[model samples]
Target chain A: MDPAKLLDILGNENRRKIIQLLANRPCYVSEISSRLGVGPKAIISHLGLLEQAGLIECSVDEQRRKYFNIANNMRLEVSVSPYSYTVTLHDVTFDRGKNEEDPVEKEIPPGEESSTLFLKLSSRLKELKKRQEELAQMQQQLQVEYTEAMDHCLDSIEEIARNPVECELLFELLKNETTLATLCYNLRLHPSIVNANLIGLTKRGFIEYGIKNNQYYWKIRETGVENE
Target chain B: MDPAKLLDILGNENRRKIIQLLANRPCYVSEISSRLGVGPKAIISHLGLLEQAGLIECSVDEQRRKYFNIANNMRLEVSVSPYSYTVTLHDVTFDRGKNEEDPVEKEIPPGEESSTLFLKLSSRLKELKKRQEELAQMQQQLQVEYTEAMDHCLDSIEEIARNPVECELLFELLKNETTLATLCYNLRLHPSIVNANLIGLTKRGFIEYGIKNNQYYWKIRETGVENE
Candidate 1:
């Protein structure tokens, strides 16, 4: 199973329980539905997700199909020690059914798969950036001017910067590991307006960024941004 | 915010990220959208869920109405001592808007609020049990029973005599820390099946229960439920 897909699937609480059910031993779908106390449809919904993640496999017996088995190549390791502990998080990927012939091995190192995935990821990112640039150039050639609500939202921000709810969310986004774009989108404002806020913060030296492919890694600074 | 509602809202990955975003300070919709690379519309959808959960609130500022803030009152108390430590696990609760005529004077015990909540919860359970029983009796009177699928979902002592998850959940319920309903709901199953599972396990002498309203205190036997 693609470790990335598995991670996304297991990221769900219901799917986690389904995986736990199969972890003990393989049982038929009906048995799982009974034990889990969920409708067959619900169980199947989660089961399909889990199966796609490569956490479990199924066997067909006559007309009745039973699911019983963990993926041999599945990598979910939890090592506990006094000082250091390791949890090799996995996610589902596109290439899943390829290595069914050779038994999958587990436990090499925590960052090994990530490094491998990153190598491919960087190349993909480059291709994506190139395509985005092409799109931008095409739009430019078409003399297309973007209509972003930057000025509209900036007017709103300046007027109600002290609004309790807005302030609270601003503070929260910085504290947690979330991106600025997430905050803006959640607020249903234009990306340009969000970019304006980022720019304001950048000028105030409260948020820093490094741009790559028209994307910025907005990092929080020690001093609060001078919205005022 | 209702901690339970917040929990449910944060329970999803996308929603959780939105909440995590607000952990720092207030921001607007556009910031959230661009940073996450998600469409502003999608982030708005998630924000709507968070708002309904009361984990978030929105504000209209001029032309650009920005969503910001969380409704929470609980604070975390982390106390560390030599060899032993106390950690206060509190979730924010909503309070009525009232005048504070007097200066803050008293210091209350940390667990006092939890105690009051529990007291209210017990009475609430009593009401629910009375209603559930009335419904159960009515169904019986009507000679109507749940489908075979539901009956099969009932906990089977024979099948899960040594199941680890059931044992852990039962132990917690018996300790007054939670209820079977909570366990079933969290596990994404019907509550009735949870009860049946408890009943089956209890009959096998693997667990013991003393019912108070609908809640039944269930615990493992002398040897205790085996982990493996």
Candidate 2:
């Protein structure tokens, strides 16, 4: 329900374009789809998010032609100066001076509410700036950690596979269960070579063997090592 | 950068919590990390995103302790109701009637600026509401289309791999490229069964074998089917 969430909904480029398209008038899904050159399915998802954010609303006619339009009674104002930036949104009706019964005690217009809120906000600007700095550092650290996490997985896989042949074998073992004869046949390698890779794979705990109908077959190990 | 980008930067719960913590006073990263019970690394990443959004700022003290504080001269306010929601931001100095040089002319306070903006906003509410309805219908259509697309893919995959085992094999191959022996070993199935699955897999063009250094290795086909 926070207005900040609206920004998240609009953060997407497609959503913003959708807003611009609907800014002046309402539009149907197919119309927007054709205009944007995107699949109707994707446009629907974006529109759903927008509606949830209260930026847009929808209706369906008897023919099942869905129409979309922007929400009403909402105001968004963003002003930025050299030293500071401010974003304020108001959907509540402000009847500050509308009650004229007390002319003797003139009521300041509802804009007074904003200035009061703004005063509180301005006072906290120093604090917000500090949070901004922390956020910047956090983003950098996340990118590094994300890369490290990915590299760690890849490195473990590479370690298990060791060589291209072993890698290919592990990759294949990852998919299907087969016997030594079948592996050798499909791999176009000697049974001895296939046996060597099989032994290595078994040692890595990546795979195990079983006998069915008096014939041996190999399959992925049941343990968590398969993920690696 | 667009201000909407800020929403994405602050969309994370951690970042929002960080903002609330920093709203009152400055604090070091370690302090925030310990309070939030998040690792320093994660906190650092969150701080980075907040900083990028310009919601907070930081400085390193002589003790090398980075102190974070909120930015100054900024205000963000959001209001929401069942029928509508509004977001307004102001970051500029309000000059009501600062200059006394001009006689006989009283400058309306800066709150007047908001009133004017609100009037403009009110006028556009009708247009926005229409857009909202259109957006809602678009979203519904999109959901149907998305489900339809997903169903189509599932139907195709099912048609190709009728058995559950074959389906599992296809799913795994979709992720990795492996050999017959390894596939048999990992899947814990008989080699003959693996060979049958391999035959089916090759037919579907999901995989292909190539000879490298006298050894045949299986790899995913280069075609876009790899994603499926």
Predicted candidate 1 versus true structure: per-residue lDDT over A67-149, tens digit per residue = 65544323232211111112233221223333233232223223324223222323333344345335333322211111011
Query: Pairing residues by index, what is the TM-score of model 1?
Result: 0.34
Give the alpha-carbon lDDT of every model.
0.44, 0.53
- Summed over model 2, clashes come to 92
lDDT value for model 2? 0.53
How many Å off is the CA of A64 in candidate 2?
A: 3.9
Docking category for candidate 2?
incorrect
Taken in order, the candidates have interface RMSDs of: 27.0, 29.1
Score residue A50 of candidate 2 by CA lDDT.
79
lDDT of 2 by residue, B112-161 (tens): 24223222322233343345334333433333332233223233345456
The local lDDT score (0 to 100) that residue B91 gets in candidate 2 is 37
- lDDT by residue (A109-213, candidate 2, tens digit) is 343233232223222332433453443334333323322322232333454466776755654453356888877765568988888988887875666799999
True contacts kept of each: 0.00, 0.02
Give candidate 2 regions above 4 Å deviation. Answer: A52-54, A61-63, A76-89, A92-228, B52-54, B75-228
**After best superposition, candidate 2 residue A225: deviation in angstroms?**
73
